[model samples]
Each structure stands twice: as C-alpha cells, then as structure tokens.
Target: MADLRRVTVRAKTPSEKPTTVDHLKNLIDKVGDIDTVIGEVMSRMKLESRTESQMILSQDTEGSMEWLSTNISKINYGQHPRFSVPQRITVLLPLEALRDTPYLISVIDTKGVEGTTQRPDLMAQIEDPRTVTVLCCSFADAPGGVPLSIVRETIDAGSDAVSADRLCLLVLPRNDEALKIVNDGGDVPSDREEGYAIREGQIDQQFATDGLPGIPVNFFQVGADEPEDIWRWLTSRIEAIRTAKVERIKRHVAAADNLVTNADVAKTRQARHTIADTMAKAAERFRKLRPMVRPAHLNLIAEAKKTHQNSIAASVNRKGSWDNFPVAHILGQGVRIDANLRTRDTFVRIDEAIEGLKDDFAHLSDVAQFLENLKDDVEEARKEFLTRVALAGRNLYSPYLSQAVDMWDKCEARYGAGSGYRVDVSAIFQAQFEGDPNAMTATEKVEAQVGSIWEQIVIDPLLEAAAFEDEE
Candidate 1:
C-alpha cells in the first residue's frame, strides 16, 4: 500500500521570490591612513616566501574594496564637490612564481624638502657602489629607481640605470651585524664586483658578481617608502637661500628709490617757496603802481565837465549863432544868421584855444593812467610767470604750455567757425519778448533764415575767395 512514487523537481523562477518590507541597511567600515596601506602593501610585496606571495596576491580585490569603503567616509567628511580614491598597487608578483623576489627598493621617510645643505655630508658616510632602491606610492616619486608594474597605470617613471638589464637586489637585515655596519659609519663595499650579502632571518643572498649582464634589474632594497628624498631636501634648501637673496636685492632697490623720491620732494618744496616769494614781490610792485594811475580818470571827467559848460555858455550868449545845432546837421555847414555871430566867433576861438590846452593836459593824464594800469597788469602777469616757474620748476613748463596751447587750439577750431549762427528762433523769441509780443512775432524766425542764407551766399563765398586769393 505504501507505494513509492517518483516526484518531479522543477526549478523555481525569479518571480516566485517573496518581497520583504523590512529595510535592512548595509554599510562597510572605512579604512584609514592611505600611506600606511601603501607601506604595508610594499612590505608584503618584498616577501621572499612563496606562501606569503600567493596570500598577498589573492587579497587584491578585497583590499581594494575595503580601501574604497574607507575613502568614501573621508570624502563625506571633507565635503569635497568631486572626490575619488586614487588607484593603487595590490599584487606585487605572479602567483605561480616559486620564490617571491620583490624587485624594487624603498627609501624610508626621506622628508625630501628639508636638510638639503647636509646631503653631501650624508652621502660621504655611505659606502661606495651601494645599491640604493627607492620605493614610493607612485613610481613618479622615484626618479632613478626601478619601476614595478603591479597594478594598472601604477608606474609613472623610473631611472634608466634601473631599467637596464641585470639589477642586484637584496633585502636589508635588521640583525646585529647590519646594525653594526650602520653604526660603524664605514664603507660596506668599495666596488660593485664585491657586492654585499643580505642575511635576514633564514634568507641569505649575495649580490655584486658581474657574471650576468644585459638583464634589466628590479632591485628590492627594503627600508622605507620615500622617493628622491635627499635630492628634494637639497633643492628645497637651495630655493630658500635663493629666495632670501632675491628679497635682499629688492630691499636695496626700494631703499635707493626712496632716497631719490625724498630728494625730489625737497626740491619741489623749495621751488614752491621761491615762487610764492616772487609772486609777493610782484604784487607789491603792482600796488605801488596802482596809485600813480588814478590821476587819468579824474582828469578825463574834469575835461568832459568843462567842455559841457563851455557849450552851454556859448549856446546862451549867441542868439542867432549856430553854436548849438541839431545832431542831424553834424556833417554839413549851416548858413550864417547875423554880424553879431561873427564877433562872437572871436570869443569862441579864444575859448577853443583854452579848451585845446586843457585837452592836451587831460590827454597826458589819461596816457599816464593807462601806462600805470598797463604796468600793473604786466607786473601781475610777471608775478604769475615767476610763480609758475618756481612752483612747476621751469623744467616742465614747456610741455605744460604746449599742452595748454593744443587744448586752446582745439577749442578755437570747434567754436570759432561761426557755428553759433544756427539760431533756434523759437527760443530766441521766447527769451526776448515771451508769447505776448505780437508786434514783431515773426522777426526772429525771418532774421535767422535771412542770416543763414546770407552766410551761404555772402559769408561762405567771401571767405572762400579770400582763402583762394591768399593761396595765389
């Protein structure tokens, strides 16, 4: 009755899975100290054991993911708009390689930007034909070291010597003998033929037998992760010294300029004082001249008064004489009226002689006053000239005058061409009589039109003709 029936098992489809409503958040912990990671990776690569090499190579993906997760936290904390984790080296050597040979050198903590002046001293202490391998996070940091391409685009540049075939690589020892060599401050080997031997833990390797040639070397001198530290230190110190020298030169130049400026300022102040003094003297002279010139105006007024009185007196005495006449008959002689007028002419002639004498004196006084006023104006001008010379120091006056004359010439050229004749008649009418002036309502407009036509027909032609005549 218990019949065993074969049950058919079918594969489940993707749609058959149940969706969960619970929100389970996942996040990886962040890594720290990218430099420390780089150092650790480099140290692992330099391992001589095959077992360690395989282990290090296999951890590449996991290490990279961890590094990314850690770097993300740094990005969020730094709050950078654009951030990215830099590409790094993971696997150092091939997995199947029986023996792990870290073909690279690492210099530890060179702190290149400092202690440049003491580089030669430090180099003197090192032994001759020393194998120095520089290790850096990027090959660009090592200028003369062998580059190992352990990751994508990880190598930037390396030294030609290291790139050549046949490199002597050795692991530095931390044993007492190695410490003794370091402390002794003596040479390890004088030549490459007698290369040094590395005895670290159970691994002992000897280098410096020039038997193999043309094999480009990848050296691993394990120490630290610095690239060109000595060179950087020397260069930075040299730059500091050079900068100091430049600053000293600049200070000297600035001091010289200040001296020259002070001298110029002193000269300018002296010149200004001299100009003020000259102006004062000229003003005093002008004041002295002003009083001497007052007699002319007084004499002119007196003469005018006397002439009017004489004319009135003659007009009253001569009843039929033409002594007083209408202004309209000024140009023509009038007919005689009587004999009494003839006798009166003799007295008028005598009076005229006296008047002539008075006029001569009055004219001399007017001339004297004019000369005095002219002298005052000339003195004022002279004072101004002296003031300008003293204040501007005469050296710059010619250029100043030239510029002034040029500006004046431009002004004259613009305004002296009768351009003012373009009269806006409405404005003129409004200014002259306002809207209430009906008597000569169209006068301004007519005059403006006539003037424009006159200028075109007569003024322009005459000017052109004169210019042509001058040319001829």
Candidate 2:
C-alpha cells in the first residue's frame, strides 16, 4: 500500500497544438495582414485546455523565431513569407498536473519600431490567475539600437500590473557594465526597485519590507554553452522550496508537544495544572492548524509521551525515601511505655532518626523541609508533657515535687512552651502524598500512630492527674 504521507507525482506529456494550415488559411482570408491573422488564431486557441503544463508563447523575434520556424511551417508560405517571427515557446510543466501549482513564465517581446513604446499582445496570454507571473528580459539584446529607457519602461509597466506575491520581475545583465545600469535604476525613477540586482550589489534590502511577502529579483548568468547547468539550478531551488515548507510545519507541531511534556514533569500541583492548561490550548491550536496529522508529527507526540512517563517513574523513585521513613513505627510503640524517662528517651531517638534521614531528602526537598519542621513541633510537645508531670506530682503532696517544679520552670525558660508551635507538617507531607499509592499508605500509617501517641502520652496522663486532684 502506498503511504498517505508521501507526495507523489505522475509523468505527463505536452498536449498537441490544434493549429493547422487550413485553420490559419481561413483566419488569413478574413484578416488583411499576417499579424492580424496570427493574433486572431492566438486569441481563439484553446491554450487553457492543457492544465498539466504552463505554455509560454514568446513573441520576441530574437529568442523565439527559430522555435516558431521549426514548429509552424505553414506560416512561411503565407503573405508574410520570411517575415520576422517570434521564436522559442517556453513551457513550465507542473510536478502534479492535477494540483494547482506555482509556475513562473517570462515572455520578452521587443518587436516594435525603435524609440517607440509598445506592449505585445502575447502579454495578454499570460493571464492565468492561478500561476505566478515573471517578466524576464536581459539588457544584452536590443534591436535597431533601441535605447535602455524604453526597455526599463517596459519592465516597470509589467511589474506594476500584478501584486507582489503573484508577480516577480527578473532583469538579466549580459555583463558587469549592464548590471551596474540596472542597479542604478537605469535612467528610470520608479518606486519598484529591481527584485534581484545581480552580480555586484545586494538585493536583501529590497525584500526587507514588513508584512509584505518578498518579491525576489535575483541576478544570475545563463551560459549558452552549458544549458544543463541552468536546469540543475532550477530543480535544486524547487526541491529547496518544498523542503522548507515541510520543515516549517514540523517545527510548529514539535514546539507545542514539547511544552506539554515539560509541564507533566513539574513537581507542584498548581504549577503542573497551570502549564497543563497552556498545553491543552496549544494542542487545540495545532489540531486546527494541522487537521490532517502526518506520521512525522505522530512520532513527535509519541516521543513526548515517552518522556513524560519516564519523568513520572523518576518522581516515584524519589518519593520512596519518604515512604520508607520509620516515624510511625517509633511513635506507635513508644506511646504505650509506662516509664516517663524512657518515653522521653524514645522521642529523642526518633528525632535522631529523622536527622539521620536528612541526606535522603535531596531528591524530595519539600518532604525534607516538612520533617525538619516536625522536629520543632515534637520538642514543644515534649516540654508541655514534662511540665504537666511536674504539676501532677505537686498536687499529690509528694516529696521532691518542689524540686521537680523548679526543674520544669528552668526547662520552660530554656525551651519555650508548646502552645505557640503552629507548624503544619502533616499538611505539607499530605500535599506530596496525593496521587501516590505507596506514599499515601505510608502517610496514613504514620498519621494513625502519631494520633494515638498524642492522646495516650500527652492527654491521658493530664486527665488522670486532674481526677486525682478532684478526689483529694
């Protein structure tokens, strides 16, 4: 099966001309002169019938006379025998004849008397709205010493008729001297600068206009001996144009996909959500711009998806450190301990364990910061527990209670009270735990144990002390 993405072109031959001696004779009988007869025949000719190729029937006597002589043999026998006839019909065949293609053709007609301004009827034949028009003429050839002013006027008139995008004017210079004359505007002060001032000066300035599509007038030498060289040059240019168009489309699609993939790799929910929204809008734009997606564009999308998946895997691995932290195991068992000194000691060891895992927090910085903040909360809770224990002993009228109270006061002065500690370590950790199964499981386990420990170690002892005081 043929790949739908690849553009294909089928070969085609030029359609045969319908002009015959009988047809020309009939037109000549009605028309007085051969020029009128030829004009009538040309006007009636069905040149538009062949959509596959662009035919340029040049009326320039110098360039196209030989071609006309060889093709139209019946023209010689008429009343205009051995008269100056146009030569060389230039044809630009399309890559795909079925498709509307951009084709440029030039026809130079300098058949008028010297010092007289005239436009050829052949210029009228160049009215295919679908194709781009290029009027090309060189300063090398001038019949009967025709001045440069007349030639300049002719070129200026042709270019003025068409829009910049659809029309291009190419002026070929025979030598370095002719090139200089063309560049200096050739004694004609006109707004239309030479599109391609070839050989010496730069034409880049002429095409630098903002918002207007560049009308290129390039200067290049055409060798009579090496005609194949010019054909190769033209073919290379056509291929370059095609390649540039394809690459431009590919670049736009790739840029859109890359933005979305980068957003997927972000750590924070707000950042990720914001960027994802942008990506969605970009994707919509791409879809509208390129409705028929190519295989190359699909490949870019696939690569972006693969990159996002890889980033997710890396993120999961980084979060494993938090999941494996033993905060829950230490607090769960320590809360049930009967001895006050031992319970306090267990918490000190838990603090040490948290401190030890600091290096593991490199990949997961937010989780590490939460753990650091949790240390301050734990210290404040310990100070409150110690003060309550001292109070409970004093209420029982126990000996050494006075000394314990003094020690509690000193500890409070040194470490500050737990009431002012308002850091939300659990909330911070929960933010990281969302959408992650292993991390959520670990967080739930730790939270359940921490809740149990807070009630048992901190609340239960205070409640028992209050009951004892009431009984006295």
Candidate 3:
C-alpha cells in the first residue's frame, strides 16, 4: 500500500460535504471487515512501495481533517505499479467560488490585444482526473436524475486550480440504492451503464462557454456496482494521472528547465565526501602504506637487498608479483594477489613508496626533505610515476568529467554564470601553479573531478529514492 501523509487546512462552508462523500464511505465499507476492504484496495492498486499519499478533507473549526492510510510491506517486484500522483487528494466542500468563476479569464497584454490567460494544467493530456465527484444523476435504468452540469462546475474548477495535465470525474449512483447485481460476474458491468456516460452536448457546451481548452468530464455510473467493479472503472483514469505527473518531471529534466532540481547533483557530490578510500585521503593511506610498502627510512625491505640498493632499491622494494601488469602503470593502483579487480574499493595500496612522496608528502615535511637528497632515479621515478598516474586518471575519469560538464552546462545556460555551477573540464585538468594562493597540482585536481563523477554514478539513485520517499 502507498505510504500516507497528513496535513490540515482551514474549513470553509461549514458542515457542507463533497458530493462523493457517501460513495467513498460506501467503498470504504465494501466488506464487513474494514481491514479486508483496505487489503483489497492495496492489491487492486499495486501502489508504489514508497510513494507518499496525502488526503485533505475540508477542515473543521478545530483545524483537523479525517483520513485513513495504511503501510503495506511490498514484495520485491521489479517495479511497483502506480495509480495517481495527486499533490493532494482533497475532498472540498464549498463549490460557490468554482461555480461562479469563468472557465477562461480574458485579459490583455501591455500592448492592448485581448487574449485568455495561460493554463499550464491542461497541457498535452487527455484522461487524468484532478477532481472527481459523485452525484445523483440520470442513467438508462434511473430517470429524473441530476444534471451533469452541476458536478462539472465543481470538478472543472478543481482542474483549473491544480497545475499540470488534469481530468475530472462525475460518479452517479442508481436512484434505487439497492438492486440486483448484473452480468452474472461482478467484474464487468453489462445490461446497465458502467463507465463514462458523456453526452455530445456536454463537450460542445464546454467549447462554447468561454472557449475552454479541455473537455468537461464524462460521468461514471455506480448502478448496483460492487467494489471490484468500481476499482476497475477508476484505475485507468488514476494510472493516466500518475503517468502524466511522472512524465511532467521527466520532461522538465530532459529540457533542463531553469527551475528544475535533481537528486543526482547533490548525490554525486556527497559521494566524494563519504567514500572511505579516495585518492586525496593521503595522510591515512600513506601512514598505513608506509609500514607495508617499506618507505626508505624504514629500511626493512630495502636493507635486505644489498646489490642494487643505490638504484632500484633506493626508496622501496616490490613485495608481490606484478602479475605481468606494467610497473609504472601499477603505482597507486590497488592490486589483489587473487585479483577480483572489479570493485569500488580500488585504493588497496600498490606497495609502491615513491608515488606517495608526490601525492601524500604534502603533509609530511620530513618526507619532502628526504626526497631532495635522493639519487636522480629515485626522485625522477616519483615524478614519472605521478605523470603516468595523472595520464591514466584522465583516461579513466574523462567520461565522468564529461558528464559532469554536460550536467553543469545545462544549468549554466539556464541560470547563467552567476549561478556558480559552470564547469570547464579543460581548465580544471590544465590548472597550473603560477603563484595562485588556492592552487592544486594538476594531478590532485583530476582526482577531485573523478571523485565527484564517481559519486554521481553511485549515490544519485539512493538520493533519488530518498527524495521520492520524502515527497508530500
């Protein structure tokens, strides 16, 4: 079942109830056990496991509303089905303002030509119900029923208020509250009115009156209907509404709308801060690697090799087999003895000491001094190793950087440079140290950019899920 939310609003038109009040009450009491009735609803709807649903009844003077919601443990299906994504399912009592309001309010621009106002809610959609009503109305079996116009007025008003694609529904119960069920099976209605009972005059009248853009609702009948039949009647409209709402968000995203925000932007950024073993986490990794990699001053492994201690054994000694992997390329890369390399944890230490001097020695002044007095090969190895690391990172991380650049380009184009999200991939990687106080080595900066892109890939989905759960 859908997760539920609650809110309170001021009451208007005291004691007046929505036209559909009795019908909803009847649906709620479909079975002797209310729990069974709710369970049936959950199964029928197949609501998203995490979607939030809120119902707003016209409030009382005490500033309270009445609603019942349930949380069902969802099975691990590939994707849960959705019904509707109404901002709020409001059962409003007052209809006077809606009845009086014109379908299209005429206005003039500063220039003086007259035209109608913008209505975003009615865009590119056909069967989405923003408002639904139940009223006593005419059908094949029942005569002398209420006019469809009465229910249309209130629901149309509701459609106008809610922005985005919308629809309205009018439900009519049989004049005889109790009657014989039809069609032998309760699932489908036959020999009686079941679904939309729209008249040609109604659609024509909607276009005639103020040239309203959308259709007036076609009514649905509740003639001796069972709960299952009603559920069938309603699900299509609800699903349509849900699809429209979800698509609206998608369309905004695809177009990179100016005001649109996404969970990915923040999630990707958070990945950088939260990850345990990042390249820039030098101090801790270096401390742990110092003992294992056997830095020059430690003299544990280097002293054991007496012959070439001046050249290859100057800083560190290799402990494990390189496994035919290139030596320079392997620096700073985590390798496993029984290598299952396809993992997020790539910082397992390469048993290389010289690479750490350029990357991690920033915090270790003693290591920097030690590097100054080293033989040419030892010092040159660190620089050559660092250059290779930077080059490989560029190859590995360019795609992530490209995507981040792309995400930001849309943002900057929409919001302008002052928005402070403009990214230039070339400039970041090409950054040089020319006396700027806040300068970073080009290699360090590349690691940062790669780190950000990594976060976006891994964290965005979790963030999006949280955001979905947070929706009201």
Candidate 4:
C-alpha cells in the first residue's frame, strides 16, 4: 500500500557475487523496501505519479536472495508488476535499460558489480538518455583500488554520451584513499563538509570532453553510514537537473526570437534601398529634361516667326510703277497714280500667320505648365514613398515597395509609354500639324530629325541604362 508512483529500484547481483548481493541487501534494509522508500521520497518532494514504477531483480540471485525478493514483491504488490521474481533482469548488455528509463535513478556499485570494467561501454550505451546514473563504489576495494585511468575513462565516456545532462556519477568512497583517488587531483577537503557532508565539486577535465565542463559531481566522504544525507543530496541533484532543463528552454526561445528579428531587419533594408534607388533615377530624369525646355520653346518661336515673314513677303510687292514715280509723286500718289496697294489676299495671309503664331505660343505656354506640374507631382510621389518607408518597419518593406511601384506604373501610363516629355512632344506635333499642309511638311521634317535624336540621345539610353541597372 505504498505510493510507488513513477519510481523504480533494481537490486542487481551477478552470479557468485556475494559482496554485491550483501551490499544491496544492507542498503535495502537501511532504507526500508525500495518501493516504499522511493514513494516516500517522491512524496517529500510533492511529486505525483508521472510514470510506472519498476523493480528488476537479476535472475542470477533468484534463489540466492529470497529475503530481498520477498520484501520487494510484498512492497510492489497491487502496483504495476514489470517482472516475476524468477524472471531474469536483463544485464542490459546493450544498455537498453538507459534508453528505456526516461527519468531513471540507476544505483550502480562498481566493486562487486559484474560490468564494472566495462564502464565505458555502460556509459556509451546512453543515447541522449534523460536519466541519472548513481555509480556507487567503495574505491578502497576497487580491484587494485580502481586505477585513476579507469576512473578518468569512465568519466570521459559519460561526458561523451549523447546527453551529458542525463548522466551523473555519484562517487561514494568508503575511506580517505578512495576519496582522494576520486577527487582526481582537485583541492576539495578529504574530510566531510557542511550540510549534506557531500563535497560537491566538478570533474577537473578539459572542456573538449563532450559533456558541459564544470557540472558539479557529488562525492560522499561518508559511506552508507549517512543514508539520510545521501538521499537528501540525491534529491537536490535531481532538483538541479530540472532547473538546468528550464534554463535551456529559455535560451532556445531567445535564440529563435533573435533569428526572426535579424531576418526582418535584412528584408527591410533591402526594400528601403530599392525604393530609394528608383526615386533617385526618376528625379534625375526630371533634372535632365529641365534644361531642354528652353530650347524647345525657342524652336517653336523661330518656326512661327519664319512663317509670318514668308507670308508677308509673298503677299506684298512694289511693281514698276513705283520706280518711275518721283519722290513727290510717290508721296502724293493720288495725283500721279495709285501703284502698290494692300489686297484682301495680303490681309488674309497676315491674319493667318498671326493666328498661327498665337497658336504656337499657346502650345508653348501649355507645355511649360505641364513640365512644372510634372516636377511637382514627381517630388510629391517621392516624398510619400519615403514616408511609407519610414513608417513601416522592416517587416512591411516589401508591401510598401509594391505600393510605390504601383504608383509609378500609374504615372507612366498617364504621362507617356515611358515618360511625360515624350508625350508632350507628341501633343505638340498633333496641335501644330493638324489640317495645315505647310505645317504637316514641317512636322514631318521635325519628326524625322528631332524624334530620332530624342530616341537615341534620351529615351533609348535611359531605357538601356535602366535595364542594365535592373540586371545588377
């Protein structure tokens, strides 16, 4: 009627190993039944049953250790029974026991244990096993006092295990020599310390060893005489393991957050750069067109002036009568003869030229206004796009850039296939050449010469440069 919970204690005794059997028997008697002791210990810690408890007894000691077997069976009655007394405890030659026990508390005694020499093998068996192996040994009786080489090798094996946190080696030395040997040249006192009388020190091995270096390993100066102290120390160690696990979780969470943050920052910077570069190119195009405005206006004015002069010359002519007439007769023309005179045709030609000039001037004025407004529009768009970049953090850069590109597309559509100035030229030609034969001839000449030059010098180059930049 014990609260076994998720606890298991196996009493292992290899055949003919009387010392091993005796040691387990004595420890059981002192601690009461293994099941009862574990349940009580868990209760003290206020832990509930998270897994089933198991008690494994080696078949080698089936008939040999009747007293221990009967007591274990009695204690484990009515709870989950993993095996019968006669059933053999698998030596776990494969270390399968380590893997199977999720929260294991293995109590191993090296001196009289069957697999003591294969310490490395036992440690290596743990494949990231989350269990604590309490390797108890009286180093004094460790075949030739457990050579430091074997001790180091065992520690190394445990460290190299997949999960070092899951392995803990608790050295319970019987005497001074054993304690000193296990200390492995450290400065811890050979005598007992305060509290648990457990001198908690770290394995003095290099960090290159697989396990985290400097994790404290408890060494009991007093042997089985202080069972309570030993149990208390073991409990504290378990608590430490739990604490370390929580800390690892926190670290992992922080690492994940940092990775996400870095990604966002990088994307934002790239988006910002793309938008800024596009705006800069657009502004530069506007700057280049500003100087060309004056030349365009002058060309229109010149064409208008030539048309007006030609119209006047063709209409007005002083004939031979004027040459024969004296200066007085010319001045008094009415008495001599009325020679050269303004005709209706002359008046009409002059009026037509004047109207053409006025239309040309109007076109020029409209173009000037369009250019000024275009500059303002571009500046405003640039400002708005940059403001979006500033407002939206790096995470939203892509969306903002998409919006800016959409706006630019609209501008392109409204202005011209590629630009506003190109559209302006087309509009001017339409206005100047409509319904006038002479103007149409002039327009064809301007289109053949000026249009080709504009495409070669301005439009084609701009597009080509933009294409090249996009490739990069």
The lDDT values for all models are 0.28, 0.35, 0.31, 0.35
Ranking of all candidate structures by their lDDT, best first: 4, 2, 3, 1
Candidate 1 residue lDDT tens string, 163-274:
3211222223222333233112345534222222212211111112212112222212334313344344333433444564576566556545544544344443443343
For residue 40, what is the lDDT in candidate 4? Answer: 57
Would you give me the overall lDDT of model 4? Answer: 0.35
> What TM-score would candidate 2 get against the native?
0.24
Better of 2 and 3 by TM-score: 2
Lowest summed-lDDT stretch of 10 residues in model 1? 328-337
- lDDT of each residue in 176-295, candidate 3, tens digit only: 322333322444333434323223233345445643444324444443546555544445544555676676556445435322432244433343233213323432333221112211
Candidate 4 Cα outliers beyond 4 Å, as residue runs:
1-116, 119-121, 124-127, 139-151, 154-225, 256-263, 267-472
Report clash pairs, candidate 3. Answer: 121-164, 128-167, 129-167, 268-456
How big is the positional error of residue 325 in model 4, measured in Å on the Cα after superposition?
Answer: 99
Error of 2 at 47 (Å): 14
lDDT of 2 by residue, 103-218 (tens): 44333432333211221232232223233344454534311122222223223222221331334444454534442444444452232223223322432332332222334343
Predictions: Cα RMSD each: 45.9, 37.4, 32.4, 42.6
lDDT of candidate 3 at residue 41, scale 0 to 100:
62
Q: For residue 115, what is the lDDT in candidate 3? A: 15
Off by more than 4 A, model 2: 1-135, 140-169, 174-217, 220-225, 252-472
Q: Estimate each model's TM-score.
A: 0.13, 0.24, 0.20, 0.27
- Any runs in candidate 1 off by more than 4 Å, and if so which? 1-235, 238-245, 248-258, 261-472
Model 1 TM-score, all chains together: 0.13
- Which of the two candidates, 2 or 3, achieves a greater lDDT against the reference? 2
Question: For residues 1-472, could you state the per-residue lDDT of candidate 4 as single tens digits?
Answer: 3333343435465544323234344545788888976655545533243233344545454353453546455533633233333212322222232223234454433223221232223333332334444544343432122223234433432232223454445555554543353343444445444212323322334322433344335555554446556667666656666786676566556545544544344433443344334434543443222111122222222222222222212211221011221111111211101101111222233234334433443334332232233233333332232222222221222232233333233323433344344334334433433544554443244324433333344334333332312223
